[model samples]
Target chain A: MGPVELGDQQMVAIQTRNLSRTFDEVVAVDDLDLEVHTGEVYGFLGPNGAGKSTTINMLLGFVPPSDGSGTVLGHDIATESLALRRRTGVLPEDFGVYDRLTARKHVEFAIETKAADDDPEVLLERVGLADAIDRKAGGFSKGMAQRLALAMALAGDPDLLLLDEPSTGLDPNGAREMRSIIRQEVDRGATVFFSSHILGQVEAICDRVGVLREGRLVAEDTIEGLRSEFDSAARLIVTIDEPTDDIVTAVRSTAGVVDVRIEEADIVVSLERDDRKAPVINAIEDAGGTITDITSADPSLEDLFAALTTDGDGTDLGVSSRNRSPGRPRATEGDA
Target chain B: MTWLHVAKKDFHDAGRSRLLWVLTALLVLLVAGVAAIPYVLAAATNDPTPTFESGLTFLFSPIGFLIPIIGLAVGYRSIVGERESGSIRFLLGLPNSREDVLLGKVVGRTGVVTVPIVIGFAVGGVVIAALYQGFDGLDYLGLLLFTVVMGLVYVAIAVGISASVSTRGKALGLVITVYAVVDWFWTFIPMSLYWILERSFPGFEDLPAWYLLLERLSPGQALSAISLTLIDTFGAGDVDLTAAGRVAGDVPFYLETWFAWVIVLGWIVVPLAVGYLRFRSALLN
Candidate 1:
C-alpha cells in the first residue's frame, strides 16, 4: 500500500486499514479501520476483554500485526515503529512504574530516554504531582500512581498521546483536571487517542469515538454523529397544572408523536423528530391545558453506546460494568 | 545516545535498590571468609610459610560454585523482572536496539557483581600479605581477574536463560542445573574415562587430547588452574594437574598473566555473545 498522508488542512493524524492481530488461534483485533485526527480527542470505547488494549499495543509496536498495516503521523506503524514511538507518548492501562525511583526520577528518565528538552519539574506540576515528586512511587495511592504514569507519558511533549483509561482512578476534581490537560495538549496541535469505559468522561473530552465489541469496530463516528444517528427518537417531558383527557388525546393526535406516557403529573411524550415540539405545544394548548414546565431530553452517547454494543441476546456490553452500575445515564451527543 | 541514557538510568536505578547493596555486601563477606581460610589454617599450625600454591588452591576452590551462584543472582532477573514489572515495554519502546539493552544490562549487573569481588580480593590479599609475609601482586591480580571473568561467564549464561525463560524460578533452576552439570558433573565424565583407561587397558599411559579439552570446558577446571598457580607462588602444597591441567601445561600457556588473560577473555566473550543472540530474539512484552 502507498503511504497515507495526514493532510495539513485535515485533522487526521492516525489512519489504519484492515489492521488485525492474532495470537496462535485467537484473533485479538480483526479487520479494524480507524482514523483519529489532529487536535481531536478520540475515545476508543469498549468493554472489558474487547481488544482495546491489544489494539493499543499494536499501535505502539509492543506487538506486531498479523495482517494489514497503518500509519501514525505519516510514519508506517510496522516498519517505522521507533520513529512513531519517539513522536508518540502512551500511558498503558496496566500500571507499571519503577518502584524504587521517585515520581520525579521516573518522569526524568522518560524524558531523557525520549531525548526530550522539556523540564520534568514542570510536567510534574501540571500533573498535580509536585508534592509527591520526591517520594518513591511505591508508596503512591492508585490515583496518584496513575497521575504519575500520565506525567511520564507527557514528559516528552509528544505529538501524539495515547492514554488508556487516563482517568481510571481519579476523583471528580482530578478527572476534571485530566480533561483540561487533554484539551490543552490538543490546543497545542497534538492528537490525543484515549480509551475509557467511562461514558461521561468520554462525552466530556472526546471529539469522536470508536466503539469496539467482540474484537470488531462495531461503530465509529463523532459523538454528535452518533447522537443524531442513535437518538432518532427524542423525548419531551411536560408538566401541566392539571391532568386532562383532552390533552392526552390532542398530543396523541399530533403528527410525529410516537408514544406518550403519564407519570404522576408529567406527560412524557416521545417525538419522532425534533420539529414535533412546536406541533405538540400547539396541540396541548388547543386542548386548553396550561403547561407548567417543559423539558426536552436528547439521547446520550452512553445510550447510543449501549444500544449499539449489546449482543443480539441482550446481554453483555463487553466493557467494564463494575463501578458503573445500572441506571447511570448513557452518553448522548449533547452531554458535556 | 539513547542506549547510554538507558544504561545510565538502569545503573542508577539498580544502584539505588537496597537489595543490590545487601547482595554486594554478602558477596564480599563470603569471598573474604573463603580467602581467610588458608590464613586461619596457617595461623593454627604456627607455620608462617604460607605457600603460594595453598593460597591459590584455597582461593580458587570455591570459585566454580560461587561464581555461578553469583551469576544466577545477578542475571536471572535482569530481563524477566523487567518484563514482570512492565518496565521492559518502556525500555523496548526506546529507539535503541535490543542488543544495546541486553548488553547494557549485562554490563550494569556485571559491574554490580564484580565490584564486590574485586574489593573482597583486595582485602583478602592485604590480610594475606600482612600475615603470611610472602605477597605477589601479579598472582593476586591474575586470580582476581580470573574470578571476574568467571563471573562474567555466569552472568552471560544467566542472562541468556533469563531472556529465554518467562519466570525467575525457571531461570534460576535452569542456571543452577547448567552450572552444576558443567562445573561438577562434567569432570566426572573425564575421570571415569581415565579410570577405564587405567584399569581396562594396561600401559595406556598416553591420554587423549579430547579428554583434557573436556575438562577445560568446565569453568571450575580453568579456575583451579589459576588457583594452583597462586598456591605455588605462596609456597603452599602442590595443586595436582589433572588430565586437563597437564594438557594446559604442555601447551604454550602463560600461567602467570597470559593464561589468565585467555581464560578471562573466553569467559566474558562467549557467554555475552550467546546472551546477546538470545536477547535479540526475546519477546520481552
Candidate 2:
C-alpha cells in the first residue's frame, strides 16, 4: 500500500507550531513544527545533541518555549501543562530512578501520585520486570532499568507516551521486545513519540518519522515516502556463469547503468531505476551471457536519512551551513 | 490527596534511611548528656551552690545549639537530593501540584526530625524532675513546646535554602552558616549593644528598643525566654500576696506579648512560603 494517509479525524496527540527554546544566544529548538496523530508511533530521528530531547522537553512542559507554543492531548502546552502531564508519560534518554526504592515501590509511588488505579505488579509484569519487582533499582542492569522506566511511564495508563532513545542499551532480543511492547501500546490506542539514533528500529516501528538537525526539523514524512524520495539510485546484482570483459562492458554501456563492480562470480550494477533491469539483462544476453540469478536493491532508510540530513557539500545538518539563510527553516521537499 | 500520598512516601522513605536513625540516636545522646551534666555537677561539687535553677540554666544553654543543627540536617537535602537523583522528574511530571509536593515534603521531614527532639526533651524533663525532686511540670512542658517551635523555624529556614540552591553541599553549607550566625553571634551582639548603650547614654535605663528586636532575632534567645518563663512558673516557692503583686502584674503583661509569638510564627511561615514559591518555579527536567 501507499504511505498511510493521516486523516483529520485522527486526534493530534501532540502538535507543536514554531516552537523554539533558546539558552542565551544558542537556540536549542528553532521554529520546530511537529504533529503526531492518535495511535501513531512518531519516530524522532537524530544523532546526539540534535535537539530531539529539547523538543521533547518542551512538549512535556519541563521547559517553556522561547518562541511559539504547542499542545499535548488537547491541553495547552504552556498554560495548562499540569493537565497535559496528567495524560502523558515520559521515558527520558537518561535513566534515573531512585536507588534505594524497590521497583514495586517506585511504580506504586508513581501510580499513587498520578491517582492511577493500575496494579503495579501487573504493570511490572507487562514490562518483564515482575521477577525484579521487589529488588532495589540500584542493581538493575541498563536494559532492566530501561524496562522499568517504561513501566513507570505506563503506570497511569497514559494516552500519550514519550520515549527518548528507548532502545539505546538493549540487546538484540531486548530491542525486539521493546518494539513488541511499543506495538502493543500502539495496538491499545496509545500514541508513542520516541527518539532514536538508529534507523532500522525507526523504520520497523515508526508509523511516521521526523528528522531533526541543528534545532530544526529538516524532514518529516512516512518511512516509505522518505526512502522513495531519495531513492534515485538502485542496484542490480546478477550471478553469471563466467567472468568475461565483454559482458561487463555490455552491462556498463546500458543507458541507465551508472557503475559496475564485480564480487566473486557476480556482477553488481548500479542503475537509476528498476526499469533499467530489462536493458541490462538484454545487454548481458547480447554479450553471449546467461543470467544465473538477479536481484534488485533499493536504498535503505539509513541512506535516505543520511542524504536528507546532510548538505550537497556533505556538511551534516548539525553543522552550521553557509547556504542556509538566517532564521530560515531548512527546505526538505525537493532535496533528492 | 496526591499531597497525602507524597507525604506518606517521603515519610516512609526517610524512615528507612540509616542516616536518619543515626542522626536521631546522636540527638538523643546529646540531649541525655546535657541533661545529666547538671546532676553530675551538683553531685561532684561540695560547694552546695548549684541549685535546680542552675541545672535548668545549664541544660537550656546546650539544647539551644542542638536545635538549629537538627533543623539544618533534617531539611538541607529535602528538595535538592530529589533533584540530584532525577526521581523528581517522575514526581513533578504527575498531575500533582508542585506546592503540594513541597508542603508534603516539609511536613514529612519535620515529622521525622521532630520525633527525636520531643523524646529528648521528655527524657530531659523526667531527669530534671527525678534528680532535683523540685521540677516544675508546667516549666518542662513549656520548654518542650518551645524546643519544637525552634525546630520548626530552623527546618523551614533550611528548607528555604535547600529549595533555592541547586546542590546539596551548597544548601548544607548555607544552612550551617546562617544557623551559626543567628544562634550564636546574633545573641551576643544584642547583649553587648545593650551593655554599651546603658553605659554610654544617660537616661537609657530602659533597654534600647532595638535590643529586644535583635534579641528576638536569635532562635536561641526565644528558647532562653521560654525556659526562663517555665522556671519562674515552676520553681518559685513563696506564695505571699504582696510579694506576688508585682509578679501578678508582670504575668498579665507578659501574657499580652503577642509580638513574640508573631515573630516566632513568622520565622516558621515566611521562609516556608518563600521556599514553596521558589520550589514551584524550579525547572526539574
Candidate 3:
C-alpha cells in the first residue's frame, strides 16, 4: 500500500506469523509463528521430517509459502527476498559444492557473489581447510565438504546466518569446533538461526531454542526455562556404604520427596524442589547411614524434548508442566 | 555482478572438463578434413583454381550436423546437472536471482560451445586460402559468422530445454529429440508424409507450401539458406535446390532467403524466453 522502507526498525531478526506451506495434500509447515531476536543464536529443534528444511526454504524464499506472510530483517520474505538474501549467509541442508572448484575457490566465489573483499585464505584457515586449499572438492570427504560449505557461508560477515543441520556430517570433535565457530559468529553481532535434531548440540550454544513437531512450534524458550517448563523434578541419588531401614524411612519422611527407592547400595529420591536435597542427606547421616557418593540428576532438555514431541493419550506420570492449551492437536505441549 | 561471477565460474568449469577438450579435438579434425576436400578434388581433376562454391559445399553439411551435437554437449547439462547435483542451492544461496542463473548458463555455455567452432573455422579458413585460389576473405568471414550464429541458436535451444525440464535425463531426451527433429527429419519426414498422403487423396498435385515453410523453420535449414543468401559462393551447378528451395523463389517475402535470418533470431530468442519464464518460479529442491 505504501513505498516499502529498506531499514526495518523491528528488533527481531526473523519473525513469521502464521506462515504455512503445503504440497498438494500434505502440509509441510502449518500456521507457524516464530520470533528470533537479533544477535541471538536460536536453535530450531525438530525430529526428521518435521518440516525444518521446508520452513527454512520458505524463509529464504526458495519455496514460496502456500499461505500467510513473514519477514527477515524487516524485508518481506515473499517480496524482498533478494534484499533479505543479500544480507544473510546460508548453509542450506542437502546442498552440494562445485566439485571442480577447489576449497579456496569456493570461498572466493562466495566473496565475489557477495561483492565483499574478505580474504579467502583467512576464511579457509578459519574453517580448518587451509591444508586443502588447492585440492578440488571432488575428492573431499563429507566432513571436508561440510567445512568448505561453512567457510563459504562465513565469507562476508553477513548480518544474519541460516544454517540447516550444520552438524549433519561432522564427528563429535568437528561438531564441537563448529559450535565454537557459531559462538564466534554470534559474538560478531550476527544473528545465527540453525536447525538441529540433537538436543545436546542445541543446549551447548543456543541462547533460545524452539521445539518443532509435525510443523508446529510446540515450545519456545531458553534451555533452562524449557527444562523447568516441562518437568523440574530432580533425581537425588545417594550411595551409602550399607542400606538401613532407618535411613530409608528418614529419606522418605523428608518434605517434597515424591518417590524414594532403595537399591542395593544407593538411596534414590525424586525431589519436587532442589532445596529439599539438603534435608535428605542430613536425614540419611542422622540414621547412621554413611554416604559415599551423591549425584543429583536434574530433568534435562532431552527429557523436555521427548516430553514435548511424543504423541499419545497424554498421560505421562510425574511431568507437571504439561498444562498448555489443547487447541492444536499436533502440538501436545504441557500435557505430560 | 553475481550473474557474471556465476558465468565466469561456469565458463571456467566447463572449459576444464575433459569432454569439452575431446569434442574440440574432434571438431578441429573434422573441419580440417572437410577443408582439404576441395584441394583433393582440385588435384584429381588437374584444376589449379578451386572455386569458392566447391569450398562451401561439404563444409555446410557436416557442420550443420556437428554444430547441434556440440551445442547439445555443452548446454544439455548446464542447469539440470546442477539441479540434480544440488549445487543449485549453492548458486541461489548467493545474491543471484533465477534469471541471473539461467542467463548465466546460457552465456557461459554459449562461450563453451562457440570457442571450438571458432577455432575450427579459423583453421578451415587457413586451409581454404591455401587450397582455393579464388577464395574471398569477406565471403569466408560471412560463412564463419553465420556458422557461429547457428551454433548459438542450438546452444540456446539446448540450454532452454535444460531449464524447462525437471530432471537431467529429461533434459537429455528433449535436446536429443530437438536435434533429431530439426536437423535430421525436418525436411524428409514431412515431405515423405505429404507425398504419401497426396498419392492416396489424388487432390494435392505438389507438396503443400506450408511444409516448405516448416522445413525452413528449423535452425539448421535457416542457417543453410541464410548462408547462401549472405555469400553467393555456390554456383548454379553446385546449388541443388530442394523442393522447398525451388518453391521458395516464388513465395511471399516471409518465405524468402532473407526471412531465414528472422527464423534464426526466433530460434535463439523464443526458447530462451519460454525457459526463463518456467525457470523463474521453479522450486529449487
Candidate 4:
C-alpha cells in the first residue's frame, strides 16, 4: 500500500474489518466489522462472555485475530501494535497493580515505558489520586487502584484511549469522577473507546454504542439512533390523583397507543411513537382523568440493549441480568 | 530497549520486597559461616593450616546449593506472579513486547541475586582472610564472579519455566524438577548409560571422554568445572584435578576446562531464547 494520507488518519482513529477469533471450538469474536471515528466516545457494550475483551485484546495485539485485519490510529493492529500503543493508551480489563510500587511509581513506569517526559505526580493527580501518590498500591482500595491504572494509561497524552470496563469496581461517585476525566480527555481531542457491560454507565457519555451478542455485532448506532430504531414503543407513565381504569381504557383506544394498563394509581401507556405521548395525555384528560405526574420513560439504553439482545425464546442472549451500581435508579425498568 | 525500562522497574519493585532482604541475610550467613568451617575442622583434627583454597573448597557445595535456590526463588515468581495477580496487563499494556518482559525479568532477577551475593562474598572475604592462611585475593574474586554467572544460569532457567507455564504451581513444579534433576540426580543419566554401554559401573579413572562429557553436561557440574580452575590448589596432596587426568588418553577439546565456559554460556542463552519464543506468541487473553 502507498503511504497513508494524513486526512485518512485524521478521519478514522480505529477500524476493523471482518475480524474473527476462536479459542479451540468456541468463537470469541466473529467476523466483526467495527469502526470508531476520531474524537468520539464509542461505547463497546456487551455482557460477560460476549467477546468484548477478546475484541479489544485483538485490537491491542495481546491476542491475534484468527482471521481478518484491523488498524488503530492508522497503524495495522497486528504488525504495528507497539507503535500503536506508543501513541494510544489502554486501561485493560481486570488489570492488577504492582502492590510493591507506590502510585507514582506505577505511573512513572508507564512514563518511562513510553519514553514520555510526563511528571508522575501530575498524571496521578489527574486521576484524582494525588493524595495517595506516595502510598503503596497494596494499600489502595479497588477504586483507587482503577484510578491508578487510569493515571498510567494517561502517561503519554495518547491520541486514542482504549478503556475496557473502566468503571468495573468504582462506586457511583467514583464512576462520575472517572467519566468527567474521560470528558476532559475528549476535550483534549483524543478519541476514547470504552467498553462496559452496564449500559446505564455509558448512557450519559457515549456518542455511539455497539452491542455485541454471542460474538456478533448485533447493533451499532448513535445513542438516539439506537433508541429510535430498536424501540419505536416507549412506556409513558401518567400518574393521576385517583384510580384510573377509565383513563387506561381511553388511552388503549388512542391512535398510536400499543397497550395501556392501570398500574396502581398510574396509567402505564405504551406508545408506538414519542408523539403519542401528547395524544395519550389528551385522551386521558378528555376522559376526566386529572394528571398529576407525567413521565415519558423513553427506553433507557438498558431497555434498548435488552430488546436488541434477547430472542423470542429468550434462550440465553448472554447478556448479564444483574444491574450493577445499585444506587442508580432501576424504577424505569419496572414497566420497561 | 523497552526491556531496559522493564528491568529497571522490576529491580525497583524487587528492591522493596522482603524476599531480597531475606536472601541477603541467608547468603551472608552461608558465605561467612561456611568459610570458618575449614579452620574449625583443622583445629579439631590437629592439622590446623586451612588455606583460602581449602576454605573455598568447603564453601563450594553450600554455594552450589544456596545460589540455585536464591536464583529460583527470585526468578520463579517473576512472570507467573504477574499473570496470577493480573499485573501482566500493566506490564504488557504499555508498549513493552513480550520479549521485553521476559528479558527484563531475567536481568532484574539476576540483579536481585547479585546484590546478596556481592555482599555475602565481601563479608565472607574478610572472615576467610582472617581465619585462613594464604588468602589469594584475585582467586577469591574469580570464585565470586563464577558464582554470579552460575546465578544468571539458574535465574534464566527459572524465568524460562515461569514464562512457559500458565500458573505459579506449574512454574514451581518445573523449577523443583529442574533443580532436583540438574543439582542432585544428574548422575543417573550417565550411570545408566554407562551400565548399558559397558555392562558395569564405571570408575573415576580411565573413563571415556564421552562419559565424562555426559557428567559435565549438567548445569551444576558445568558451573563447578569453571570454578574449580579459578582457585589455586596450593599442592596440598598433589592430586590430579584437571579433566585431562581422568580421560583414558589425550583429552578432547570438549573435555577441557575452558569448554565448561561454553556450556555455562549455553545454559544462560538457551533457556532465555526458548522462553522468549514461547512468550512472544502467547495470547495474554
Candidate 5:
C-alpha cells in the first residue's frame, strides 16, 4: 500500500537509512528511514524546530549527516551531490535572494547553472510574476520572494523537486496558487517533497504524509489512511431542516455517540465507531429533524496531526488531541 | 575550472556598486592625473626627452597601494557575504559545486578589478604618450600585465579568506590582517627575524639568501620585483633593480628577477587552493 512495497529500483525517488544529525549534543534528526516513490508528492509534516529543515538539508547535501546515508535520483547525497542536484530542483528554507539582481536574472542564473535552455519569462509567468520580472529582488515582499524562488526551482525541468516549507510567506490565495503550480509540476511526472509545519497547508496537495516529532517520525501513511487510523472520534455533521434541541438529545442518547451539539441548521455528533453513523442519523430523523445533508468530518488531518504530534500528554487512542493547543495553526500570518 | 555563469553573475552583481565607480574614477586619476606630473616637471625644465620610464617610475608606488585595496574591496565578501545573507542557498541549490563557486568568485572579482585597471591604463596610457617623448608601448604593456596579475593575486587572497571564515566579521578582520602584514609590514618581518637570529642588524650588503627570498615572498614584494624588471626595460636608468647591486658578488637563481613570476603564480594559486579545500569541506549552516 506504500511506496516501499513497490520493490523496484526505478520506483524510488528518495531513500534514506538510519539518517541522523546532531548539533553539538542535541540530536536534530535521529535514526530516520524513508522512501518516497517516483512522481508522488510526499509531504514531510512537523512542528517548528522538529528537525524538518535539518532532514531536508541532509538530503540536499547542505548538511552532512552525523551518520547514515541517502540517495536522491539514485545519486548518493554525500558523494555525488552535484550529479544529484543536476536532476533535482531545491527550494531551500531560509533562502535569501541577491538584492541587486532582478527576478528574471534569478531564474536565468538557475537555468545557466543547470545548463537548461529555458525561458525565464515563461517560468516567471508561471509563478504569476510576469509584471515583476524586471524588478530587483530587494523590493520583493516575502511572498514575492517565495514565488521567485519557486520559479528558480522550476528551472531545467528537474526530475525531483525538493521544496522545504514552500508555503512560508503566502496568503491564502497565494498559497492556493502555489498548490496549483505544485500540481502542474507533479502532473508533468516530477516527484515533489515539500515540508510544512501546518497540516492545512499541505492537506490538499500531499499524496502521502509523514509526521515528524522531536527528531523522530511518528506516523507515515496516506491522508485517508491517517484519518481512518484516528477515525474513532471523527466528527459527524448532520445538516437538518429545522433547529431542534430534541435532535441533540436523541443523538446523544444513541449507542456509541459520545458528544452532540446543535449549531444553526446542523446537528454535530461525535461517534465512537464508524458504524455508529447510521444510528446517529436514525436518531436525528426520529427526533423529527429532517436530515438534508450529512458529512462525516473524516478526522480532517488536523485531528490526526494533533494526535500524532502531541507530546507526553493525555494521548488516549479514542481521545481528541485537538484540545491541546500545540496542534493549532500558528503560522496564520498572511504575507504583508 | 570556473563556471562562467557564476563569474558573470558575480561581475554583474558587483558592477552595480557605487564603490566600483568611485574606484574606477580614482584609478583613472591615479593613472592619467598622476602620470601627467612628469610631463609638467619636464616642460618646466625645458627638457627635450621626457621618457616613459619616468611615468612608470612615478606610478610604481601609487599603483602598489591602489591595486591591492581595489582587489580586496571587490573580493573580501564574495563568499562569506552570500553565506551571511543566506543567499548561498541559491548558489549551492543549483548544479554548481562549492569549488566552482570559489573559483568563479576569484575569476569574477578578478574581472571586477581588471576592468577599472584597463580603463585607467587606456586613459592614462594616452596621456603619458602625448606627454612623454620616449613612450615605448611594450614596456607600458608589461606594466599593465603586471598590474592585472597583481589584481588577480589579491582577489584570490581575499576570496580565500572569504571562503575560510564562517562570519562576515571574521572575513573582514582576516582580510585586513592579511593586507597589513603582506603589503605594509612584510619587510619588517624579515628584518625583525634577521635582527633576532644574526645577533646584529642586517646591512644592505651580503644579506642572507633566505632573507631576500623571505622579503620577496609577500604578493606586494613579488609584484614590485616583476615591475622593477619592466621599468628597467624602459632604459631610462631611473631605478637600479638588479639584485647584484644590493647583494654580494653573485645572486642565487631564486633571487633572480624572473623568479618573481613564480612567486606571483604561487600567490594566485595557493590562496585559491587553500580556500577551495576549506570551502568544499564546510557545511553551509
Candidate 6:
C-alpha cells in the first residue's frame, strides 16, 4: 500500500521519506522511502551490506542520516529521537549484553530503561528463559543470549518492535519459538518490523515483505503476490497405472505444456498457465493411460525470492549509485 | 531520568567487578601505611610527640601518585570500550541520547572512583587522630574533600579519552600519555625549556614565574597547591617575595595558591566538554 493510502486510515509504524545515510564515499542507504503499517508483521529482507541495518539505525536515531528525514511512531526521527525511542522496542544488530549481569537483571534493566511496570519474571518466562533466570549471561550459549535479548526487546509491550536479525544465533527449534512469539505479539496488535538475510525465516510470518538490493529497495509485496509476479511455471502430476509412449506424446502436444516426464507411477507435465491443466488431463486419458489421482503445485516463495534477488546475469543485485540527490525519493512501482 | 537509570546501571556494573574491589583494597592498605609513618618516627626517636608537618607531607606525596592511578583504572573503559564491544548500540536502542550516555558515564565513574578515595582518607584520618598530637579535624576534612575532587579530575580525563577514541587500545595509550605528562612529568617541561634557553643565551638563570602558572594546569600540581594552602604548616613559608620583584611586573593570577581550585575545576569540565562535542557527531559502526 502507498503511504498516502495508509496514512488516511491506519497509523504508520515506520515511514522514511527520501532517507539517506552515507559513510565517506560509499552510500549505505540511498534515497529510500519506506512505509510500514501498524499491526502487521513486515519482513525486511536483505543480504549483508544491503543497507537494512543502516536504515534501521537511522530510524532508531542511533546514526544520523546524511540527508532526508523520517519518523517512527509519529515522532520525527531527526528532531525528536528520544520520543521516537520511548515508544519503540529495538533488537539492534550486533548488540551486546552486559556479561556481568544475570538474565533477570538484564530484563529488569530494560524495564527500568523503558519505565515499564511489567514484571521481569513474566517476560523471561514468556521467552522460555525462566530456568536460567538467575545465571550470569556470560555463561549463556548464543541461543540463550538471544532469548534474553528478545525478552528485553519485549519489555513494556511496546507499540512497535524493530528486530534486526532477530534470529541470528538461534537454532532451528529456537527460531521456531521466536517466530511463534512474534506471531503472538502481532496478534496482540503490535507492529513488528524484523529483518533477516535468510528467506525461509520470514516467509511464514510476514504479512508483507520488502526485499532490499544493494542500497535500494527492489521489491515489496506479500509472499503470494511476489510468487505471481516472478514465478510463471506450475507443475501437474498425474498418477498413472502404466507408462505409455502415447501418453507422453499426447501430454507434450497440449497447449501451454512445456515438458513431460514419466516417473515410476506418475506422469508429470510442466505448464506455463494453470488453465492448461484440463487439456493435459484430457490428453492423457485419450492416450489410454488410466489416471488414479491428479495434483497441481504452484511455484513456492523460495523460487520467487531467488529470482527477485538475482539479476538476469545470475549475479546478486549489485547496483549502488553515488550520484543520487539526498532529499529526493526515487520512484518505484511496487505497492506494499 | 533516563540518564539516571543508565548511570545507576553503570555504577552497579563497575562496583560489582572484582578488579575494582581489589584496587580499592590496595588503596586502603597504602593509606594505612602512610598513616603509620608518624607512629614509626615517634617510636624510633623515643619521643612521644611527632611533628604534624612530617606526617602531612609524607601522606600527601604518595597520594599524589596513587589517586590518579585509582581514578584512571576506574574510568579508562567508560565509553570506547562499549563502542568497541558493540554495546553502545544497545544502550542507544533505549530511550537515551548520546549526551545521556556520556554524562551518565561521567557521573557513574566519578562515583565509583570516589569510593576508594573517601575510604582511604577516612582510614588515614583515623590513624592521624590516634597517633599525631596536633591533628586538626577541620583541616583534614578539607584536604580529604579536595583529594576527592582531584580524583574526579582524573576520572573526567579518562572518560573524555574513552568517549573520543574509536578503540580501547588507542584510548588507553592516550590516557596514559596524559597521566605521564600531567601527573609525573609536568615540571620537566619548564626544566627542559630553561636548559635550552641557557645554552643559547648563556645568562638565562632563573625560571619564569609564568612557567609555574602553566604547570598548574596539571590536576596533580593543582591538588598539591590546594593541599599546601589547606595544611598551612608546609609550602607557605617558601614563597620568595623579594625574588618575585626582580624579573616580572606582577605574578599571574593562576600562580597564586588559591587559584589552583579553578584549575582543578577546569580539569573536571574541559575534557568531557571537548569529548562530548566530538562524540555527538561521530558515526558509530
Every candidate's DockQ is: 0.39, 0.43, 0.59, 0.72, 0.58, 0.59
Q: What is candidate 2's lDDT per residue for B196-221, written digit by digit as tens?
A: 76665322234444555576556555
- Which residue segments of model 5 deviate by more than 4 Å? A1-10, A233-299, A313-336, B44-49, B229-239
Residue-by-residue lDDT tens digits, candidate 5, A1-336: 122334455488889889999999999899889888899999998887778899999988889999999888888889988988988898999999999999988999999898899999999999989999999998999999999999999999999999989998999999999999999999999999999888988889999998887788888889888767667666677888896777777888899987776667777777778788998888877889887887766544575665566644323322343233424443422211
lDDT of 2 at A54: 84
Model 6 score (lDDT) = 0.78
DockQ for model 4 equals 0.72
Model 4, range B1-285, lDDT digits (tens) per residue? Answer: 699889989998987899889988998899999889989989999995877788987888898888998898899989989988989998888999888899899999999899999999999999999999888898888888888998999999999988988899999999999999988899889989999989999987899999889999999878867876776552233666557778899999999989998999888888888878877888888
lDDT of each model, Cα atoms only?
0.72, 0.73, 0.79, 0.84, 0.83, 0.78
The B-chain TM-score of model 4 reads: 0.95
- Using Cα atoms with residue i matched to residue i, what is each candidate's TM-score against the true structure? 0.79, 0.78, 0.82, 0.86, 0.86, 0.82
- Candidate 5: tens digits of C-alpha lDDT, residues B71-189: 88888999999998889998998988898898789988999898889999999999999888788888888888888988998999999989998898999999999999898888998
Across all candidates, the chain A TM-score values are: 0.75, 0.73, 0.74, 0.75, 0.77, 0.73
Error of 2 at A274 (Å): 4.4
A1-336: candidate 3 lDDT, tens digit per residue: 211333564368888889998888898888999988888999998777778899999988789999989888888999988888888898988887788888888888889989889999999899889899989998999898888899989978988999999998899998998999999998898999999877878898998999887788888899878767435456677899998888888888888887887767977787888788899999999999999988765544555666566653222322322333211123322322
lDDT of 2 by residue, A1-336 (tens): 111234656578888899998877888888988888878999998766668888887877667788998888888878887787778887876646777778998888878877889999999998888799999888888899888888888978788888988897789888898899889888987999999866777889889999887787888989877766545456677888985899999888889987786767778787777688899989998998878977655544555565445553322221222223322443332332
- Candidate 6 segments exceeding 4 Å error: A1-7, A231-298, A313-336, B192-209, B229-252
Which of the predicted structures, 1 or 5, would earn the higher TM-score when compared with the native?
5
lDDT of 6 by residue, B96-151 (tens): 88888888898888888778777877887777777777887676776677667777
Q: After aligning candidate 6 to the native by TM-score, how far in Å is the CA of A335 from where it should be?
A: 26
> Model 4 over residues A230-324: C-alpha lDDT tens digits?
35656677789885667678878889987776657777776677777888889989999888987766545565576455542222211122223
Tell me how much of the true interface, by contacts, candidate 6 captures: 0.66
lDDT of 3: 0.79
Q: After superposition, how far is residue B199 of candidate 6 from its true place, in Å?
A: 6.8
Which candidate order results from sorting by TM-score in descending order?
5, 4, 3, 6, 1, 2
